[model samples]
Target chain A: MTADAAVVVENAEKWFGLNPALANVSLRVHPGEFVALLGRNGAGKSTLLRVVARLVKPNRGRVRIWGVDVARDPERGRERIGLVAHQTYLYPGLTARENLRLHARLHRLEGAGERVAAALTEAGLNLSADRPVRGFSRGMQQRLAIARATLHGPELVLLDEPFTGLDLEAAELLSERLRQWAAAGRTIVMATHNLEQGLEGVTRWVLLDRGRIVTEWTGDSTAVRSRYRQFLKGAPPGAQGRRT
Target chain B: MKGLQKHLGLVALLAMMAALYAIFVLAPVELTMGVVQKIFYFHVSSAWVGFLAIYLVCFCSLRFLRNRDRQWDIRAAAAAEVGAVFLTLNLVSGPIWAKPVWGIWWTWDARLTTTFVLWLIYMGYLMLRRLVDSPEQRARLSAVVSIFGAVNALVVYMANRWWRTQHPQPVIAGGEDSGLHPDMLLALLVTVLAFTLLFFCLWKMGCDLERTRDSVESLRRTAQRHLREVR
Candidate 1:
C-alpha cells in the first residue's frame, strides 16, 4: 500500500441473499486523485461508495480507509471519509449555520463555530449562512452541501451526482472547487452521468456496463474516449453475461 | 443490546401472565366492580408501555436530528411502531374495561379524547414515510414529526389534569383515584416490566426486517445491472 492510496478494497462482494450487487470489486484511490465512477443506472456506483463509507457492509471483502478496517472501527473510519449526493442532506427548516453546526456537533469538532464560518465563506455561502436553507435556490443549496462535506475536512470525498441540477456556471464553479479540493491532496471519487463533466479533473477512469467493470484506463483521454464509446455500444448486448 | 432484545418481549409476556394470574388468584374482588377489575392490570400495563415507547421514540428522534446517524432513525421507527401497537391496545381495552365498570362502551372524557388524537398523529407519521421519495428525506421528515408527536404525548398525559372532566371520580388515593393494594400494586409492577420487554422484542424484530428489506432492494439493483450488461 502506498502513502497516497487513500482507499483500498480487496475482493469486495456485496449481495442481497442470492443476488450479488458487487462482485470481486477491487479498486485503489490514491491521494489527490479525482476519479469518476461511470456506470448506467443500477450499475453499483452508489453501492460501491456506500460500502467504502461504511454505510453498508460487504459480504466478502475488506475495505481499508487510510489503512483502517471500516468494520473494526466505523467511527474512526468515517472520520476520513465524506459523502455528498443529489439530496442536500440538510434540514430545510434550519438556517445554513444551524444545519452545519449540527453536523459539527456530531463530528465532535472543537471550535465548530469558527470552522463553520470559514467553510461557509470558502463555499461562497457567507451571505446565506443565517438564512434558512429552504429559502435558497438549487445552486445555492448545492453550494451549502459542498460546504457541509468539507467542514470536517475528510481525507477522501465521495460525491454522487454533484452536478445533477446545476446551471452551466454553477457546474463550472463547483468543478473548480472539486479541482481545488483534490489539489490539496484529498482523494475524490465522483459518480456522474455527464460524461463531459466526468471527464474533467479525472486522470483515471473505470467504465461500468453493468455491475462489473468492463474496462479501466489510467491516462490518455483519446484512448479512454475511444474505449468508452466501444463499451457503450458493445456493453448493453453482453451486459447480462458479464454480471457474475 | 442482544440481551435487551432477547428479554424484551419475553419479560412483557411473562409479567402480563403473572399479573393476570395474580388478579384472578390472589387479589380479592373489588367492592365496586367485583371480578371485572381484572381488566385494570392489562389496561394500565398497555398504557404504561405505550406512553413509554412514544417517549423513547421522541428522545431517540431528537438525538437522530442532532446526529445524522440513520441508525437512530431506525430506532425511532421501531419505537413508533411499537408505541402505536400498545397505544391501540391502551385505547381499545379502556373502552372494554369501561363498559363493565362504568356502564358505557365509549366516553367523551378528556383523557380518552386526547389519547385518540395522539393515535391519529402517529398514524399520520406512518403515512408520511410512504409519501416520501428518499431515505434521507424520510429520516429528516420523520424526526420532525416525532418531536411534534412527543410534545402531543405530554399534552395527552396532562389532559385530565389540565381540565376537569365528566368522567367518574377516582376510587384510589392518587389524584382522581386511591392507590392500589399491596398485592395489586406488585402485580401491576410485574405487568409493566413484562410489557416493556415485549415492546423491545417487537421493536428489534421490526428493525431487523427493515434492514433486510433494504439489503434485498440493493441486491435487486445489482442483479438488474448484471442483466443490463448481458443484454
Candidate 2:
C-alpha cells in the first residue's frame, strides 16, 4: 500500500467498553480493487467498512479515503465515498423519484432532474419511481439504494451485504455492474456472506475472525469457495466477543 | 478539558453551595413580595441557563451542518436535552412563584406564553430525535429543528420588553433606574454563575454518555443486520 491507494486504514482499532470490536485492522486498497470481506456473523467486517466510510470513528487509528484523512476532515473524504449499509437510508415518506431528487439536492449535483431520471432507469424502478419508497419491495428498495449510493459518481463504493433480499436475476445484474465498475477503476469494498454471489466481481478475498484479519487470498472463484466452506465448517457458533 | 473545563464539576459544586447561602441568607426579603421572592433567584437563573443551552444548540448545530462532524451533533443533542430540562424548571418555577405574587396560578401573557411555547419546541426537538432511526438523518433533522428553536428563544427573552405583559421587566439590563437591590443583584449573579457552571458539568457528562450510547447502538444495529443477512 502506498500514498496513492484509494483507501488506507492504518492500525485501526475500535473498542466497545471493555470488549474489543476491532483490533489492529490495517488494510490498503489500490484504485479499482474489489475486495470482498468474508467472515462469520460477528467478525467485524461491517465495522471495518463503517470505519472506512467515516460512519464510525475508530478508537485508535487513521483512515484516509482517496488521500483525505477521515478523522481530520471526514466531510471532504465522504464526497468520494458511496456507502450502502443494511439500512436503505431512504425516507419512506418520499416517493422513489423524490428520494433521488432529495439526494441530488443534498449533494448539489448539477442537472438534478436528469440525474434522478437516469438513476430511476438504472435501478429498474422507472415504473414505480413516482410511488412511495415504503411501498416498494425489498429488492426494489435495495436497487434504488444502490443507484442512490452511486448517484454522485463517488470514487469508492462500500457495500455491506448488498445481495440481501435480491432475486437471482437482480443479484446477477448487480454483480455485472460491480464487474463494470471494477473495470472502469472505481474502488469497492463489499462485506457479504453470500460467498457465491460476492465472488463474481472480487479481485481479492480477505477473511476476518474475532475482529482480526485472519488471512487473504487471490485465486479462482471455485478454489476460494472451497476454502470458505472449509473455514466455516471448522468454526464454532456465537463465538466472537464484544460486551458493550 | 485543557483549561477551565477540567475542573468544571468541582467548581460548580462549590458555586452551588455559595449560591445557596447567598439566596437564603445574604439577600434580604423584599417588603413587597415577602419570602417567596426568593424563588426569583432560581427562576431567572434557570431562564438564563436555558437561553445559553438553546443558543449552544444553534451554534453547535450550525457547526455540525458545516463540518458534518458527529461530535458537533452530539454536542447539539446534549445542549437540547439540558436546555429542555432547565426550560421545564423555568416553566414550573414561574407558575409556583406566580401563584403567590400575582394571586393566580397562570396567565396567558406574552412572556409566559412565549416561554411555554419554547418548552414545547424543545419537546418536539427531543421527540424528533427519537423518531429517526438513521444517525446521520437524525443529526441533520435535529440540527434544523434546533436552528429554528433558537428564534423562539430570542422571542421568549424579549417578550417582556416587546409586548409589555404581566411578567416583570428585566431588572439586570432594563435601564439605569430598573436595577435590583444591591444584595439581591449579587445573589442573582451568584446563582446564575452556579447554574451556568452546573449546566456545563451536566453537558459534559451528557456528551460522554451520548458517545457511549451511540457506539453501542451502532454496534448493535450492525450486529442485528448481520444476523439477518445470515438468516
DockQ list for all candidates: 0.11, 0.06
Q: Where does candidate 1 stray beyond 4 Å? A: A1-38, A42-221, A230-244, B1-12, B165-176, B229-231
Number of the top-ranking candidate, with TM-score as the measure: 2
Candidate 2 share of real interface contacts: 0.00
Using DockQ as the measure, the top candidate is 1
TM-score of each: 0.56, 0.63
Cα misplacement distance, residue B64 of candidate 1 (Å): 3.4
| B1-231 per-residue lDDT for model 1 (tens digits) | 767556776666776687667777777777777777777877788888877877788888898767556677778888888888988998988888788866778765666777788888779988888899867678778889988988987877587655644445443223214766888777677777777777777888888887788778878876875665566
The digit string of per-residue lDDT tens for model 2 on B1-231 reads 567788888999999999999999999998867999898989899988887888899999999877667788889999889988998899989889888877887876666777788888889999999999767778889999999999877767686446754546433223322667898899999999999999999999999999899788778976875665454
iRMS for model 2? 9.2
Evaluated on the second chain alone, the candidates' TM-scores are 0.87, 0.86
